[model samples]
Target: MKTVYGPYRSWRLGYALGVDPICRQPKVCNLKCVYCRLGCGGIMVTERGRFVDEDRVKEEAKEILDKEKVDVLEFRGTGEPFLAKNLHEIVRALRGLTDVPFGIVTNGTMLGRDDVRKELKDFDVIVVKLDAVDEDGFRRTNRPHHSITFERTLAAIRDTIAESKGDVIIQVMFYKGNVALADRISELVRDIGPSKVFLSTPQCPEIPGLSKKELTDLVELFSGMDVRTIYTECAKER
Candidate 1:
C-alpha cells in the first residue's frame, strides 16, 4: 500500500499531501464514528503499535517532495494516525525532506498520553475531532472504544490544546446525531480555546449532511473564536 498519497485541494489546508502511518488493510482505528467516510468494519484497538515502516514512509515522502508542491504534509489516511507508534520517527525523518509545514488530523483519543502529545507538538497544525460534548452524543456520533470515555476524551483535547506549541485546531462535524449539542460543544471548545475551530457536516454520500442554513446558525455560536465552515470554504474555493 502507498504510504504517501495526495496533494489534494483540502478545504482546510489547501493542497495537502497525505501520509498514512497506519497503511493497513481493513483499517485500524479506535473509533467507529457514524459519519466516518471509511464506513463500518475495521480493526478497533486502543493500543499503540508500529504498523508501517518509518524508513519506507520517508522514502516515499522524499520521492513526492522532490517532484511535487503541497501546502502541508498531513498525517491522516484510512484510520487514526496516533495509533502508529513510530509516528514521531516518520515526522522527524520527513521534516528533513521538505520545508512545507506538517499537520495531522486526529480524533484526540491519544492526546492524553505524554508521548503522543510530544509527537503532536512537532506538527505545525494539529486538527482534532470534537464532535460531541456529552457521553450520549459522543457514543451516538463517535462510538469510541469501550475504554474511552467522553469525559476523558474531552479533557485530553483540552489539555493538548493548552499545552501544544503548534496550532491546535478543533474540527467538529455537525449532523442530526449531535446537532442539538452545538451550544454545549461550542462552550467546551471556547473553554479549551484552540487556535481555530472547523465546523463541518459529513461530506460522505451515506450520511446526510446539514443544510447551509443549519451550518450558518452553528457558526454564529462560536462567535469569538477563529471559525471556518465547510460551506464557506467551498464557496471560497469556487
Candidate 2:
C-alpha cells in the first residue's frame, strides 16, 4: 500500500491532503531535516525556477474539497511549496475554487525575500519550519542549502510575520541530537509572536530514527508557552 495518507485532520489548520505543488521534477530546498519524507534527494542550495501544472493542482484541490468538505487546503508534500516561485498565483487561483482556508508549508528561509513575503501575505495560514533556534542547531538539523545563511533565514521569518499579520504558525520538530535550544526557541517566539508556535516530532516514519517520547517531551515543554500545539499523530488518538 502507498501509505494511505490524507485527507487527515491537522492540529492548527484543520484537514489536509499533503499535496506537492512542484509535482516532483528536480529542485532543491533550504532544509535537509532528518525527519523529512523527501529522503536525501530534494536538498538543493539554489535554483532559478521550475514548471508545475498549476491548473491540475488547483483542480485536484477543488475536487478533494468538493468531495470531502475539508476545513483547510494545505500545500505540503515531497518538497517545499514556496519553492515553486509561482506559489502566490496558485494560492490566488485556489481561492476562487473553494471556501476552504488555504495554507502553505515552508522552511522559512525564503520568507525574508520581499517578493516571497509579498506573495505569502494574502494566505489564510502560513506554516514555517523552525527546527533550530540558533545557527548551530539550524545547521545541524536543517542541513540547509549553502546559499542560505542561518541569520538570513531567521530574520526573514521575523520580518515576514511582522509585516504580513496573517496566521503565521511556526512549527518546531524536535529531534534528539540535532535539538534546538528551548530558551532560544522561546525567545524567538516571544520576539516574533507568530499566530501560533507548534511543537511536534516525526509521528510517522517520514524520517527515520525518531522516537515518540522525544516528541511528547517537546510538547510538554511548549505547553508552558502561549502557543498551540498541532499534534498530528498524537491528536488522532484523541
Candidate 3:
C-alpha cells in the first residue's frame, strides 16, 4: 500500500497537495468511534510508537513539498500524531523544510500533557475533535479505550487551549443517535476559545448515523459563534 496518497477531498481544510504524516498508536485512546475508516473493532492501544520511520517521513515530506504545491500539511492518519515519541522533532523538521503552514487534525486526547501541548504550539493550525459534549454521549459515540475518561479528554482540550499559540479549530461531527448537548457544547467552545468551530457531518459513514436536518439546525444554532460549515457538496461524497 502506498504510505501516502491524497490531495484528496477535504471540505474544511482545502486541498492537500502533499504527504501528510500520521502516527503509530503508542498510547491508549478514549474513543472507539464507530465511524473510523480503518474499521478497527475498537479503540485500544493495540500498537505503539511511531510506526513509520520518522526519518523516512521527514525525507518524504521534504521531497513532496519540493515537488508539489501543498495548501496545508495535515497530521492525521491511522492513529494520533502526538503519540509519536519524536513528535516535537518531527514538528521542527517539518517547519524547517517548508514555508506552507502545517496543521494537525487530532482527537485532543493527549493535549493535557505539558510536553504534548507545548509541542503542538509550534504548528500553524490545530484542529481538535470533540464529537459529543457529555460523558454519556462521548461513551456511546466514541466507544473509547477503558483508560480514557470523559473528564480527562475534556481537561486536555481546556488545558491545550490555554497554552496554545496557534490557530485552534474545533471539529464537531453531527450524526444520528447522538444526543448532542447544544448548550454544553457551546460552553465547551467558549472554554477552549478557539479561533473558530466547524459543524459538519462525517465525510464517511458515522457510527451513530448521519442527519442532514440536525446538522443544518446545528449550523444555525451556532451561527453566533465564529464557525463555518463544510460545503454540503464536498461532504456528500466522503
TM-score quality measure for candidate 2: 0.84
For candidate 3, give the lDDT of residue 118. 70
Worst lDDT 10-window in candidate 3:
18-27
How far out, in Å, is residue 123 in model 1? 0.9
lDDT of candidate 2 over 121-217, digit per residue (tens)? 6577888888777777778788877778889988888777877767888887765554547656766776777777877666555454345555556
C-alpha lDDT values of all predictions: 0.87, 0.67, 0.67
TM-score winner: 1
lDDT of 3 by residue, 1-238 (tens): 2234455556666666333344333323445675665564534662335546657777777776677776777776656666666766666777777787778888887777667767886678888988777777888767766677778888888777777778888988766555357667767776767788887665464355446666666766565677776655464222
Ranking by lDDT: 1, 2, 3
> Against the true structure, whose lDDT is highest?
1
User: What TM-score quantifies how close candidate 3 is to the native fold?
Assistant: 0.83
